[model samples]
Target: MATLLHIDSSVFPGETSSSRSVTDAFRKAWGEQHPEGRVIYRDLAADPVPHITATAHLAGLAPASERTPEQSAALAARVELIEELEQADAVLIGAPMYNYSIPSTLKTWLDNVILAGRTSGETPSAQGTPVVVVASRGGSYAPGTPREGFEFVQNYLEAVLKGSLGLEPEFIVPELTMAPRVPAMSELVPLYHASRERAFVEAATKAKDLAERLAV
Candidate 1:
């Protein structure tokens, strides 16, 4: 059976987190479509990955056989993470915008998985592995908005995962997530709920389609 790696980076729990709720929908659809398929879940907010340190950075660059004990220990967790990604047939990520960028916990996981030789280096291409990202933002960042260019989450992820890592990713974004809760955004509540609904629907559809297509 095919395997999927599900990663959630939201700090909030339950329905309070748009990204998590959307990803949960995706997971539900995926499970229904591929009941026998394997799923590996990692909750970065609850259990954050270690940030890449200078030593770990150097360790990843060197040949595994040549690393020292310290380097080997430092690189172990990262190696495991990369192995999980490489082994999976597909990936799903719950990515929420924080301070105009991805969560630091998610960033740390990316740093761990974007390894040379293991994930991207010398591979034919990474595009064959599909990735679905459920991205949610507190405010709207679409074109023509005041914060149009300020949004960096999607662009940065695309650049790293697709441009650099060669993986093909599809993004489902829910904007104005804070509208329902923030008095300043009360006028945008309708749009917020609409966006939220669309995100879950899109995620479920994509998950089912991908599972069917990728399942062996």
Candidate 2:
């Protein structure tokens, strides 16, 4: 059976969070296809990982046997985080845009797992793993949109997951998430629903495809 590492960084837990909802759909479809598969879930909003501190930085630089107690603990956590990714056949991330970027919690998780020799060495690879990102944005940031240049979530994640970690990824983005909730965006409600529907379809399709491709 394959193992999927599912990470959700949405502060909103359920249907309110578009990214979370889309990832749930993906997992639902993936689960149907791989009933015996294992899912390693990490809900960053409920149990947030710590950001890299000076001690943790030193731990990564120091030799394993020569590390201080705090450094050792910090390094051990990093090791566990990296191992989770290393063992996974595929990875799924729910990253909702916050202030035109990914949440701080997601950033913290990235900081924890991005080790020098492990995730980003000269021969770096997320063990040749594949990742699916359900990225939800509150407003439109497409090619001709006024906020196009300000969009950073998908671009930054692609850089880190592909460029830094050497992992292949497919993204499903649902834009204008807040249109239905904001009175000013009333006219965008149709677009919002359409984007959301498309995201779910893409998520399910990609999840099943990745699951089959990565199955052991």
Candidate 3:
């Protein structure tokens, strides 16, 4: 059975996050398809990933084969992130856009997951992990939309997931411009619920396609 890791980084669980709704849909379908599969979940919004401190970076930068005790320990935590990834055949990441980019917590978790000589080496062929990134926003960012400037999150994530990590990370974005849902804060609750429903449907379809391809 395939191992699936569902990583969600959304600040709003009660109100419903666009990204969170999608990721959960993906996980549910994936589980149904692979009934015997092992699944693990990490909610960064609830228990955030640690920020990479300067000291941690200093330690992490040391040669993997020559890490000192402290360096080894620091890098060890990062290794756990990668091991979880490596052991899994598929990964599902859900993150809401923050200031037109991925949340800092998600970014921090990625810093730990995409390590050298594991997710990728100095060489490109060595990198073959596949990732699925689901993003949500309060606005639209379709190719020709006026809010296309908000695409920085998708662009940055694709670059880092593929370029830095040397892996292919497919992006599934469901944009729900708030205008339709709410005229003002008073309508936000209703809009939030509507967005979640839409997000779940879209994500279920996208996830099935991705899971089938990856599982094969």
Candidate 4:
């Protein structure tokens, strides 16, 4: 059976979070396509992973037999996360922009999984795995937008997920998410709704497409 690794890093819960809502849509569509498929979910806000430490970092470079007791424990934690990625047929991430970047919890997860000569390097263990990223933001940061240069969530993920790990990444962005909440941006509420609707459609369509591809 197919397995999906879903990670949500939104601080908000349920439908209150735009990224979470969209990711939920994608997951629902995926479930419909593969009723028997397995899903491994991680809610970073509720249960965040430990940040990489000096011991953990160094342990990755050392042989298993040579690691100290402390290093062995730290490395074991990282290995668990890495093994999840390697075992997954696909990955889904809710990476809402926080201060023009991804959440610290998500970054911590990446740091743990990305080990040199293993999950990364010339032949990554999870290479070619398809990863769908739901990158919702409060404002517009697309090309030609005023704050385009300030966009770091997708850019950083692209570098780490695709460039380093060799994963196939496809993004579904829902921008201007703060339009309805922020008074000053009230005029853009319509645009925000449009973007959100498009994101939902894309999420469902992409989920089905991926399911079909995996089934084949």
Candidate 5:
């Protein structure tokens, strides 16, 4: 059975978060399709990732014997994270578009887990299993609408994952805002926010369905 890696980076829990809820839907669908498959969840909210520093960064390429004690220890934790990502057959990401971009926490984790050499480095082509990126945005960012800014998050993510990490990203699907918002939407502003969240669920359902069929 395939081993799926579910990474959730949203600060809000349950229905409060558009991104997390959408990701949860994908996970649920995946679970239904592959009951026996293992799903390893990494919650960046509860267990925050460790920050990378200059010494720690250099230590990753150094031979074990040549590294300082602190550098070696720090590198160990980071290497393990990369290993976990590489081992997974599939991956699901929950990202919320903040200021027309991805969250900072997700970027931090990406910087750490997506390493060179082991993941890409010598690899001739961008080779790896594709992961789904599901996001929710308050403002409308559809193809032809106004305020449709192409943020660097999706573009940068695809490049790095495909080039450096050797991890192929399947899609950059963002459920965005539009006309009438959603139910339980208190004020107009809140409703606008909630609508974006609802779109996340809708988009995630489609991505999950596609993935399940492909996996089978």
Candidate 6:
């Protein structure tokens, strides 16, 4: 059976979070397609993984036989995360833009899983795995927009997930997510709704498409 590693980092819960909502739609579609598939879920906001520490960093670099007790303990957590990524057939991430970038919890998760010569480098263990990222944002950041250059969530993730980890990444972005809540951005509320609707459709379509590909 196929295994999907699904990670959500939004501070908000349920439909309150644009990223989570879109990811939830994709996951629902995926579950429908893969009734017997396995899903490994992680809610980073509720139980954040440990940030990389000196011992953890060094432990990853050092040979297992050379690691001290402290290093072993710290590295064990990282190894578990890496193993999950390596074993997964697909990956799904809810990466809401936080101050023009990804959440710290998501960054920490990346740090834990991206081990050189293992999950990363010239030949990564999980290389070519398809990853769908829901990169939702509070405001518009598409080309020609004022904040176009400020969009780091997708750009950074593209480099990290595809460039570093060698995963195949495709993004479904829901922009102007704060339009309904922010008084000044009320005019963009319609646009937000359209973007959100499009994202949901894309998520379901992509989920089914990926499931079909995986099954083949």
Encode model 3's per-residue lDDT on 80-195: one tens digit a residue. 77778777677788867888888888899987776555565686432666677888877667688788875888888888877887767877776663545565644455655566
- Per residue, candidate 5 scores C-alpha lDDT tens digits across 1-216 of 877888888788877776777687777777877789888888888786887777768887787789999988888888777777877777888877777677778888877775556566886222576678776666556668676666556676778777677776765454443223554323456556456555555655755665666577
Model 3, C-alpha of 76: deviation from truth (Å)? 1.0
Model 1, total clashes: 0
- Over 126-171, each residue of candidate 2 has an lDDT whose tens digit, in order, gives 7478999988999998889999999898899999998889898888
Report the number of clashing residue pairs per model: 0, 0, 0, 0, 0, 0
Worst 10 residues of 1 by lDDT: 118-127
Q: Give candidate 5's total backbone clashes.
A: 0
TM-score, predicted candidate 3 vs. hidden true structure: 0.83
Off by over 4 Å in 2: none
Pairs that clash in candidate 6 = none
Cα-lDDT of candidate 6: 0.95
Candidate 5's displacement at residue 82, Å, is 0.7
TM-score against truth, every candidate: 0.95, 0.97, 0.83, 0.99, 0.80, 0.99
User: Which 10-residue window of candidate 3 scores lowest in summed lDDT?
Assistant: 177-186
Clash pairs for candidate 1: none
lDDT of 1 at 109: 91
Candidate 6 lDDT by residue in tens digits, 94-186: 999999899999999999998887888889999999999999999999999998999999999999999999999999999999999899999
Using TM-score as the yardstick, the better of models 3 and 5 is 3
* Candidate 3 segments exceeding 4 Å error: 64-66, 123-126, 184-199
What's model 3's overall lDDT?
A: 0.74
Candidate lDDT (C-alpha), each: 0.88, 0.89, 0.74, 0.97, 0.70, 0.95
